[model samples]
Target: MIELPTLYHLATPDAWDAEASDDYTVSTLGRSLAEEGFIHLSLARQVSGVAEAFYAGRDVILLALDPHRLSARVEFEQVPGVDDAFPHLYGPIPRAAILSATPVPFAQDGAHDFTGLLPEPL
Candidate 1:
């Protein structure tokens, strides 16, 4: 998979914007993502499990698991059935079910450490 981590769109949106949004929208979006475990990950890799989770069609927290470099965090709408209905999921029944998700720039310092929030050497 070509890890295009440099692509700028894979970023999280600003918090001020969230504050501007109606609380219901934010809470519902968060709930949907959390239910699916859709962690925000770059869409650069084909085998990225994280990417697949977001494909589940729920809003998610996008960020670089690698901490040494700065990255963007953001949310997106998951269009269900569209991923498979679209001509190219690279496989059959490609619908995504998120294992979990979080929304924040700084990785949570506690149990949220499940992802290690650090870069792995290639």
Candidate 2:
């Protein structure tokens, strides 16, 4: 399988805009990095499901992050009943790791649709 160079982070616009520093250091809100110890992430195919379940009608942004540039350790962990593992970054993220930030589009039914936002498969 071909591995993409980047991964996606689903974030609130206010959280990203307010907290992301000029130096590229960012703290993810809701993920509770200090308490849970990691920031949640989803693969291209996984974004839709995650949005539907967690974010739903809330406005969110899809952040494109270069995995290689992240200061934290990213791990793909299996959750109960889920077939595929999800990516989790075990530390604060840096702005330099982010390649782009795009608003997550809403479907006619008012759910986040990540179709065009995700990177094409490499």
Candidate 3:
């Protein structure tokens, strides 16, 4: 068997909770899988920046996803201005694929403080 890298998704507590079935359909904070066409995922090193950029001043849950458990296709696509390619899941995330759902802490300045929240070498 091949080992797949763990991917991350920053979601609101409400959004994550809404997915009560086997498949999670929410794409991002405000978008749905049907609307966005794909779920945005980040690498460990990109989690902090993504949280700061899109989810600043908000409390979020960090979902650790095991790609090997997912049935959807995970594609790494390069955005127009982004330096690194980002992983996008073409289908809804199955409940089994979520390894962990941890609450993210925030700093005094209303920014997400991802210290100690991510894996090592991040």
Best by lDDT: 3
Comparison by TM-score, 1 against 3, better one: 3
Query: Top TM-score: which candidate number?
Result: 3
Per residue, candidate 3 scores C-alpha lDDT tens digits across 17-122 of 8447658888888999999999999999889889878898888999999999889899999977889999999999999899888999878777887787788882
- Provide the overall lDDT of each model, using Cα atoms, as 2-decimal numbers: 0.28, 0.76, 0.88
lDDT of candidate model 3 versus the reference: 0.88
Encode model 1's per-residue lDDT on 1-122: one tens digit a residue.
43323211122343213233231112122333234343323332322333334323323354322211222233334547434211111111111212123442323432122144333436
Clashes of each: 8, 1, 0
The regions of model 1 sitting more than 4 angstroms off are: 1-60, 63-96, 106-115
TM per candidate: 0.20, 0.83, 0.91
Select the stronger candidate by lDDT from 1 and 2.
2
As for candidate 2, its clashing pairs are 24-95
Cα displacement (angstroms), candidate 3, residue 81, comes to: 1.1
By TM-score, rank the candidates, best first: 3, 2, 1
How many clashes in candidate 1?
A: 8
Q: Which scores higher on lDDT, 2 or 3?
A: 3
Off by over 4 Å in 3: none
Worst 10 residues of 3 by lDDT: 13-22
